[model samples]
Target: MHPYLQIMIGFARSGVLGYGGGPSVIPLIEYEAVKNYKWMNSDEFGETLALANTLPGPIATKMAAYIGYKVKGPLGAIVAVTAHILPSLIALIGILTFFYSFRSSPFISGMVQGVTPVIAVMLFMMALDFLKKGSKGLGVRWAMILAVFAFLLLQILTLHPGIVIAIFLTSAFIFATYRGRKTMKQNFEQESREKVQ
Candidate 1:
């Protein structure tokens, strides 16, 4: 198959199989792009995800565009994005048609019920991957701890994630600045000692 076609198929599979939207799609994309195709490494995938999250568009689309650009430039980006959406587009229509055709059927409802667990599992796996990757060292590990605590508080205690994320960012910035200054001062002292010698 053509490269573009293959890329398209990969994305379509991702869309069709991915459960919980953009975040959920990451693992699928990583599987295809990193594990299967050897297009990038885990670190590159992390960077791509960060860039995607930082930008304004949908995460899945952002990834599709990036991967597509890597493989085939502008046209590839377009093709990948279109393919990523195509499955959902078709699926939505099919679902609607089924609902209309079987409005009274318990079978359709039961299928929906059955799929919910699968979606939950997929989302859980994705979350685990993020946690494993994001918590790199002691500092980041602590950061992850704080982040997760904040998230749990938000979810269970009716706090907001925005506030938690803001706090994390503020704390990180301050800590980084302090650490940077401390390192610089230490370096300066070492240089002065050498000069005296």
Candidate 2:
């Protein structure tokens, strides 16, 4: 099939099936991008997700645009974002009046309550997958430390997520630069010692 059609189907499935909101839609998007379309692997998806989070606006659309552009070009980005949001937009428009009428009904309340856990589980699983991959790169100890620190910032201190992400990103950059310089210095020292010997 054509790439555009594939993009439409993948994003449409994510947009339509994804309940709750942007966060909830993320796992579905990951499935489409990583698992279904083979557009990227899990690690690449995670990196893209991190980059998207640092940006403003809705994440799902941002991811859609990025993936689409990667696959095709500017036009692909447009198609991908439209495909991802249009389904949800049309559904909301069609159901808004009906949903508003029954917003307070017990049946509606129960339905939401039932689905809440499912969304939570999906998010939790995704988090775990990210953590597992992070541990592989940073070691389990460092990954756990960062995770705890992030949790404290987000849940306890109630810092905005964007702020927390910025802090971590800056720290990682500094750490990487320092480590690189240190390694180079060590290699230089080793070479000098070998020459003296």
Candidate 3:
């Protein structure tokens, strides 16, 4: 089989499995592109996931584009993105076409209720995975604590998600920059020591 074909199929499957949108898609894409395909390491995957979330587009598209670019450049990105989108597009069209026909059914609503809790569980697991990474750094830990507080405030004080996102993003950006500067400084000192020896 052609490598590009494999890449497309990989992305399509990931998209199909990622029913809860972008955040849920991360684990699936990571499994295929990083673990199975060996296209990148976990750290690279994590960083790309972070950067993608900050960008404007869908997380799935960003991931497909990034992985595709890494593998086969511009054309690869196109192929991966199209593949990721096509399955969902087709499924959505099909469902919408039939939605009115099923609108009055209790069965459909029951299925939706059943699925919601499962998706919630999946998201909780994903959060734990991120928290494990946050545990590695004091800044990350504190930032996460602040985020939780802000979230609680949003719920209790009736603050909007947009406001919460702004605060969280601003704080995260500052903390990440500080952590990056510290890493660079440590690297510079290590390089200087090596040169002296």
Candidate 4:
């Protein structure tokens, strides 16, 4: 099949099957892009996921757009975002209607209860994979520190995740840019001194 079609079908499939919400859907998207199609390696997918989290809207949609653009540019992005959203939108409308009618249904309630454990496990495994990737790129110590910091922010302090993320992004960017400029200035000074000698 063509690459563009793969983008549509992959995201559409994920949208259709993505139970719970955006976070739960990540493993599905990762599987579609990384495992099933070989569209990107795990590290590339991890980087995309990180970037997607920083964006304003839904993570899955952002990832779909990125993958589409990577493969086929603007039109591909449009196709991917549309396909990714369409299934969930339609399903939501239909489910809302049905659920309103069957709000007291024990089977539906039981199904939801049954799926909770599976979703938890999936999320845990995905988090582990991401942690491993982070460790590889940032070193184990920094990765552990980040994980501990995130846990304290969300679990203990009860801060909004967005606020925590904003703090981290802001500080990391400012410090990295400052350090880069400082290193460049030192290098330039050293070169000038050598030239004077």
Give lDDT tens digits, candidate 2, residues 112-160: 8999999999999999999999999899999999999999999999998
Task: Please report, in order, the local distance difference test score of every candidate based on alpha carbons.
Answer: 0.80, 0.94, 0.81, 0.89
lDDT of 3 at 27: 78
Q: Per-residue lDDT tens digits of candidate 4, residues 125-197? A: 9999989987986899999999999999989999866678778778889989999999999999999999999
Better of 1 and 2 by TM-score: 2
Residue 54 miss distance in model 2 (angstroms)? 1.0
The residue-level lDDT of candidate 4 at 193 comes to: 100
Give, for candidate 3, the lowest lDDT window spanning 10 residues.
159-168
Q: For each candidate, give its TM-score against the true structure.
A: 0.77, 0.95, 0.73, 0.83
Cα lDDT of model 3 overall? 0.81
Candidate 4 total steric clashes:
0
After superposing candidate 1 on the true structure, give the runs of residues whose Cα lies further than 4 Å from its correct spot.
Answer: 1-3, 54-57, 139-144, 152-174
lDDT by residue for model 3 (1-197), tens: 67698789889999888877867777789888878888898778877776676567677899999999898899999999999999988998898689769987998788778777777887788667767766675467675886589669778888755466566678879989999999999999999999999
Flag the better candidate by lDDT, 3 or 4.
4
Off by over 4 Å in 3: 139-197
Candidate 3 global TM-score: 0.73
Kindly give the stretch of ten consecutive residues in candidate 2 with the minimal lDDT sum: 92-101
* Model 1: ten consecutive residues of lowest lDDT: 159-168
Model 2 per-residue lDDT at 65: 98
Ranking by lDDT: 2, 4, 3, 1
